[model samples]
Target: MKEKYLSTRRTYRESVRPHDGEVRFQVAVEQTDLLIVAQEDLRHEIASFVFQVRGEIKNWILFHPEFAESLSPVIVDDGAPEIIRAMAQAAALCDVGPMAAVAGAVAQAVGDFFSPRTPNILVENGGDTYLHSTRERVVALLAEPDSGAVVGLGIEAEAFPVAVCASSATIGHSLSLGAGDLVAVRAQDARLADAAATALCNMLRSEADIASVLERAQILAEFGVEGVFAQYNKKIAAWGNVELVALN
Candidate 1:
């Protein structure tokens, strides 16, 4: 797995800004760029949580460098922090490294911190997201080069608190062996979504690989993945309960 450096970008946060009465804010700390939305201004609280989670994860990484460096799944101790355990388990399920789930795990942590105080919350770390909304939410798909094209997701309000994480080989700093434009995964937790996205993208090198990859993605259902959406060479495909919508 490649661990390339990524800078904070506003394009994705701006593209997915919710119009459903939710307030949005951006927070950048280190390599984690977050787009947090809620019923009210909770930027301070969200930032605090993000910092705490990042601190814990950083400490864990310091103790276990292998967890951060391994490209393959690793077995972590039961005493690991909740975020670390979540990442480890998600990585194991997707057969990727724990770091692959870092963004989603962090997003989920922030979401969990505010889910009790508010019924509607969205925490996006990098491109991974943990969202809970009182109204239907539309998540835009902004893959590389095809930025102007209209492709997105129509997520129901009832499916609030779900994780929608994406990975790409053609873009972003994440390590992927394949050459897919994008791989999006929806699951009960952001960790699984993130890791699965990376794993799936690493498997898709061409449009012809879609069928087999989609077949393999079916097994992810057992790991709490609800659906998958992929774009490769301008071709799009979806599986499970994902509802594709056009933004333009």
Candidate 2:
């Protein structure tokens, strides 16, 4: 039988004691409570990969617009492909264009995680996540509507590990397009998740913009997007391959 373990996914005002032997990394420092979970080794590695990938993205993408546009098609190309693909996806959102920042880097982050060993590695840099390996990973996503609480996403996996990422205007330091507190995206690769989350947030500039954004998201969804979580003007929506989790 397949093995599964569920730890105390915490949503207090402070970080929890991480599962034994897991490396700790700080993405951002804030004065408020943080949502944290103690997962298996595979999930931790994936998360680390996302952190590293996003760190690289912050180094490469945020300020570079032309180069990001240049990467649109080649994102699917291997060798750090995920983030590039994500950048291409993000480019669809703005008049200024994607320009290789948050979303694009997120994709690259997930891809970076998969680049190494084949363990069930999954990484979530803020909201952008990438998953690999054969084990099924169920991730709980935290959103704004739940009043800074945990929302459960009881996702069962197939033969491959999955990646998940989210963005928020009210939380974390990353940029967001919609005003909602949280937006998320899931894909086989972190780059896509990163790009999609950014795109979805962009779509939500206003409720008036929702249709166009969804249209654009769908137009790009054919690019093999698995799921989307978006909020604008105080609303949240989660699309395919996604579920919300609640942890008190």
Per-residue lDDT, model 2, residue 90, is 50
Per-residue error for 229 in candidate 1, Å, reads 0.8
TM-score of candidate 1 on Cα atoms, chains taken together: 0.93
The count of residue-pair clashes in candidate 2 stands at: 27
TM per model?
0.93, 0.59
Name the regions of candidate 1 deviating beyond 4 angstroms.
1-8
Candidate 1 residue-wise lDDT, 1-248, digit = tens: 32332543446565656566778888777777788887788877777777888899899889889999999998988998988998999999999999999999988888887888877888877678888778888877767533543777789988878888988876667778887888899887899999999999889888998886788789988878999998887688999979998886
Q: How close is candidate 2 to the true structure, as a TM-score?
A: 0.59
Q: Write candidate 2's Cα lDDT for 80-177 as tens digits.
A: 44455455545554222444245435434444444454344444444444555344455656654335445555556573545566665555555555
Global lDDT of model 1: 0.82
Which is the leading candidate under lDDT?
1
List the candidate 2 regions with Cα displacement exceeding 4 Å: 1-118, 145-147, 207-212
